[model samples]
Target chain A: MSGNSEMSPRRPRLAVWKLASCDGCQLTLLDCEDELLAVAGAVDIAYFREATSAAVDGPYDLSLVEGSITTAADARRIREVRAATTTLVTIGACATAGGVQALRNLGDIDDFKKAVYARPEFISTLATSTPIRDHVPVDFELRGCPISKRQLLETLSAFLARRTPNVPTESVCLECKRRGNVCVLVAHGTPCLGPVTQAGCGAICPAFHRGCYGCFGPQDTVNAPPLLTELQQLGLSPPQLERLLRTFNAEAPAFRAAAESLGAGGEK
Target chain B: MTERTIAVDYLARVEGEGALRARLDGDRVEEVELRIFEPPRFFEALLRGRSFEEAPDLTARICGICPVAYQMSASHAMESALGMHVTGTLRELRRLLYCGEWIESHSLHIYLLHAPDFLGFPDAVRMAKEFPEVVARGLSLKRAGNHLMEVLGGREIHPVNVRVGGFYRAPEREELEALRPELEKALGLAAETVRFASGLEFPDVEEDYEFVSLVHPDEYPMNEGLIRSSRGLEIPAARYEEEFEELQVPHSNALHSVRRGGGSYLVGPMARYALNRTRLLPKTRALANDVGLEPVVTNPARSIIVRSLEVHYACEEALRILSTYRRPEAAFVPPPATFEGGSGAAATEAPRGLLYHRYELSRERLIERARIVAPTSQNQKRIEDDLRHLLERQIRADDATLTDACERAIRHHDPCISCATHFLTLEVDRR
Candidate 1:
């Protein structure tokens, strides 16, 4: 299990980097309260700014990057981060897709700036929020608005053990059935993305009697056109369906295409 | 005259990114700037023209550490705008949900983020090596809180169940009952935490600062209250804009919140403790007494103690509510007919402090205007002010020592900068 890390006398150096998004995905590591100390014991947290003040000079063994490349400064900073790591893993929807803030990807950045700030001239932002892969190569991508804690642990464990992580690429419907949850879509006529959405969140929305909001982005083999047609039947207007697809994982290609096909721009 | 520069290019151990710079001539501190470089996501701008129903989930994305605060504040504001009120057991359930967030967020700040600074550790991971049991206790307590959130709201981060009127579906009686044993265990752990925190060596520093928070008449404030401050200022949540103003500075994307008549004031656990000590539940009050925490805590670093006490209160309150929880006949109240073309404002006690959300709804139930003032943004000026005070006192110290002290000082507010540049940089120049 300790194959790769054991090659060196020192522990594998791990660094976590942030770009522009909610700190949720990075927080998932901290939320590993039970396993955090153990994870630390297993590796060196060389540069995790949000969790520690101590930073070790990097040519890091593994890097976990969060957030998306939103600002020009971040665009350069991510390149620097890429140069310093052996293996890079993008965590959360923001890193994997463009995240919710990427809602800007489909609309006017200038108008967005003016709406949010009094002096839009002071703000410097990219026209669109883009994922890490758009700018740099990523060895792996862990998905979710905030990636599921169990999946996060598995990813970390696989890295520490020097093995490829066994992550499911199946749809959320499989998870819903596994959990014995009644399908909210079938029973209540609620529009749900569960059929095409990824499974990492364990069908949580259906358990709560709410339709899946697709926080995990899209399933690998998604045929979202059918899901959109079903949602239309279940009373989701084209605009409403578009808004649903463009939430946390807003700029993910599959979801983005689905929403675009519906004639709705990403902006609210 | 001599000049030297002490710079921390990146401020660490806080949520999000920010920078701090201070300039001094000899030992006289000249300028202090808490620069927030966390990229602005433009949440307030994005909320414009969206359905009011989207507010809870969309705003919850603002800060992952305190999603409940955003959700509760958004829900309450929308509910008020619709002229629909959730009361009785449903109201209690919402408070219970908030209590869960309080326990989770406070435990995280106190143990994982803030405590390592108090001790001589760079992070909690290092701290755990020396005091594994204490760290484990904190983690378990935090997990218990997350468990409650998972059961009620569907997931800890950006819970899916919370809607404007109420939850999408209320938890079954057994679902709540299942949390009892864990809460009981957490109660004991929280008690131990309060005692453990009380014994920690606190830095002997106090600043004369104004403390502000929401104060409920009958209960410790959570979802509802009147905005009050230690400086004899009291106003309804609707009057927040009337009392305070947001100033735009070139260095920060967040607007610095300053009172109309006064300057910067504190809003967080310290503020809540100072303003609502009399309103604390009985068990929490006794623990505060045992811990020797004064009603007015002036030391920012010692705010960890206040956070622990709040955790105790949250655990106790959650238990108190769960025991009598009866799954409501209907999960939520349907919105009233008066839901069109109205304005609503609400002040809820975020774990950090008072979070205010104001929304103007169009007749179509679309959000025409939205303004959200996160607690961290409100406390930015106060944080900078505290840094200046600390810098003046320790102006003669060496660069490394002084920079470390200043970083610890910023951590005192448990500043969620992600909530504020949308907020740290630490740099010191001495002459």
Candidate 2:
């Protein structure tokens, strides 16, 4: 793709799309400060608003979609994005699950709107914030509140190689154990989601002497029931457990089920 | 009568989704709208019923570019509500974390997002093909900032370390000292950045701005200060709502903030530098003087220089904190066991400008209500005002030229539209 010969086919066109998100996942690409120019050389950045003003008409080779489908226009836009790209990869919790904003999914969205805006009537939003996969088929989902840079690079490299990305599906516990650190849950009696949460963030919270807050969402084979039980035994109140499950990946199936089973339901 | 329209379907090189529209009637400007189409996540609404301790992490999601600003503002507000003050090493650590953010965020803007316009490139990637060393310096400088954040806060983007009252864990002196060499290199690079930015040709134009920023007595404001403005308006964070009000407009999702019973005001690098010029470190102050940068820069286009100067200040500040580093006994000062249920407010200087957060907590420590006024929301109207003036001057320019100029002007403030309704597309209608 970096060939200089005129006979070489043009580089794969990469387009980045944002729906409703903090713009973190895409920033991860830019944050690859050392590798950004190389990535650019490997792919033609057809569209990326946060980094470049230039754009090219798309039938892009690959599209990395960030954020969630939170508005009617965004819902419509994602379809257009899917239609324009050959491969669509959803980045971050917002695109893979529904993200922290999905807390509104469990509540009365009208009330949610009124709580923030003085003229709630003026705001145009869907009742629920949902991941990109819910609206359109996502080729792959890279998970995190803000995804890990290493994982992001791996995913991009995988796309260029036409191979499956080597992101781990194991829980944070495995990563924590590999780091040779004492378990905060076992040693400190802290309520931790490391046992159920996905790995990618390098088990940061635990290393910092805190329990995992599950920013990477649920692991592939989560048995959240036992973890909740353990948390309860560790002195977490029922409301606290429910609240913890209803954070960054609030609407991820596993977490939502766990929170719902606690009877709080994340709803009024 | 001739009618023409310039419409930018999507605005690029900005943090989030937004568009712009301007209408011109003959030579007079009819309207300028800095449209923010980014879907509102209803952060303030969702924050209710969440634990007070969750504020820092949750609010950090507001903008990827300036998560530290949100974290700092939320943490400080929660601390104020609980009547807990983090002193000594912990306080210095917060400033240090902020310096890392400023360095990273400012470098991102100067080199990647904003510089392309001045250098006649589409983006930094293209610019890199020709000016590899320049872009490399920027990326290296950004890496230094990110490395500092990683060592201290655990990760750069949405750091997992910051908590109310203090940090989840304080890095050892060695962990911090490891950053000194890179920071030293970054300081030199940042100085080069100021010089590089100063060489850019700015339009000889100035705006009468009511510049607002945090003013600290001892240091350049980052984590704490009185909210002061160039117009002699000084108030605590608690009085932020009294002085400024967010008004919802039909064209955009982000609310436009203006001084109460007054018009639009400016914030960010220009505001901070103008308000706290003397408070900058001696080296940074000397650099600014050497570059012949005015004490009070009123031209929005010259903000790139101010932002570069801030990057220099942040580097120096980070080194200063590192030089005197000592790990606090506790990772955090735990909140009081019992709660009386109170409210608190705080304003911190985000790389862009002042970010204000207020929270009302229940006796059970759950958040009852929350309000976040992002810098871009405050600057949105002022940005439109700047656009209006720019359009007036370039009235005879073609649609594409006017549209390009408008986007450049908006970029001048480095508006984080994600933080604003928390934001561009451009439309110019000439009739």
Candidate 3:
């Protein structure tokens, strides 16, 4: 963990950046109430607008980027962010995948603008919301609609120590089993994406007696086709199955293809 | 003639991406635009065709700070549309959940976001160096709220437990009972917060705000109420569109909301406190009176006191609900097996202010159309008005001091820019 200490006498500078997002992922850092001051002691919180008004100019030692790139300006701005950091970690579904806003990717952008705004011309937006990895090379991707607080701290700790983060890429079903939660899919015959979704959220939905809605996006090796077939048999129609796959991580390659196979992707 | 411009390219200490620009010509403030460049995510546009059941979770993505507000508004709107009224233990649980959000969101603003402006510090971290106990108290208070949310809603941000009719699962009696001790501590912390906020030196400034909020006859509004404004405008949520309109301005991604005939109005802590002062819990009301906070807080900078008082009420309210909570028989009230298309609208008091949601559902229960009027969006125009008025008074101050003051004034309302586009560079020009 002390691998990078010899390189600089000063504590590492950490910068938190936002693109197009709900600010939830960045908030995950603040949500670490107990660990926040300790983390601050370990590093200089040079730039984090949501928590502080302070900004220290880069080249920062580590940068945690939240949200997706949804505008041309953001696309350009993200490049600058990448250039300013030695290690760049994308946090949450928005930064790792395209988030819920990526729903625009499968619909008509013009129609979307018109639907939400009376004067569409006044809005400056890209047709699609794409993740940070699409725009810049990311050192790590922490996935969740709002990234898990535990994983966020671990990621920060790992980066400070100059080590690889220990985030697993396993499906949420594994977590559910470890949690001793009854399989909602098998027991209650409820449709769930746990079998195909990532594990970071601790299988919270299933534990809550609700079916997983795949807020964490896809797992490492998703066999979504079989899962979709099972869900369809469980009474989810083709469109329902498509809508299920096309949520927070709609633009993720695997989920996008799954939605498209169900005849639900591209401009609506 | 000398020309000067004050501009803040990227605003800090507020949620989301935003900037401020105010242009002043000589002694007169020419233009003050609360430019909400937080790229429009098209939440309303994207919601179309999704199942009505998905509204709460989906709309909760609008702002991370106040997801509960969105969830409550969306769920209530959907429940209204489906003709399903959730009452009894379920209703109490929802209110309890909202109290958690209020406590969490308010504590965040009071400590991390707004406190720095008053202390002349860049951030809370710096403030914590000198006043560790103050910062610790705030964090502890915030944790109590987040813990309460985790027990009920599953996680703090974008909780998985909320559904249309009610929660996905009802928390056990023991689960709720466990939160009481923490909440008991939080109540004292909240009172301390109110006192601390009241002690801050506020700029001697006031605005003639047309305060608006949800007003329940029996209690301080959080979930259900008729929409009432300080200017004698009272209407049900169904008539929201008839009275107010969201107009598209050339400079902003967020549409500015205004009363149909009137111009800008305020909705938030000040608004809620102004319209529902009598409805607050006795302790919270007493705390306000003890602090010498006026019944109607027109000074936006003094909103900290109002927000802190609400936090006190929320903690008390949570403890009250926890004491009386009985686990509902069912996790959620099931929607009808068959559906007939209908439209419904509802407004809920978010920690920020009143959040309004309207949805038109198709026969199949798919959301045909959706409209969301976030509190910040409703307050955007009024915020600009505040800035304009502020610039008029501080026009003689230098660009740097004036800009700093402008940013502080904006922070007073604690605008969630992320929710507003749904929502600051300050430029002062002297010629």
Q: Which candidate's lDDT is highest? A: 2
TM, chain A, every candidate: 0.96, 0.96, 0.96
lDDT of 1 by residue, B206-274 (tens): 899898899989888999988998989999899999999888888777889999978998898888888
DockQ of each: 0.78, 0.81, 0.82
- Per-model TM against the reference: 0.98, 0.98, 0.98
Candidate 3 Cα misplacement greater than 4 A, ranges: A1-3, A264-268
Against the reference, the lDDT scores of all candidates come to 0.88, 0.91, 0.89
Give lDDT: candidate 3, residue A192: 95
Give the alpha carbon lDDT tens digit for every residue of A82-177 in model 3.
Answer: 999889999999998889999898788999999998889888999989999888999999999999999999998888777799999999999999
Q: Looking at model 2 chain A, report the run of 10 residues with the lowest lDDT sum.
A: A1-10
Can you write out model 3's per-residue Cα lDDT over B295-400, one digit (the tens) per residue? 8998888999989999999999998898898888998889988887999999999998889999999998998899999998899899889888888887888898
Strongest candidate by DockQ: 3
For candidate 3, the per-residue lDDT at A224 reads 84
- For candidate 2, lDDT tens digit of each residue in B234-293? 999998998999988888888889999899999899999999999999999999999999
Error of 2 at B216 (Å): 0.9
Decoy 3 TM-score against native: 0.98
Q: Interface RMSD, candidate 1?
A: 1.1
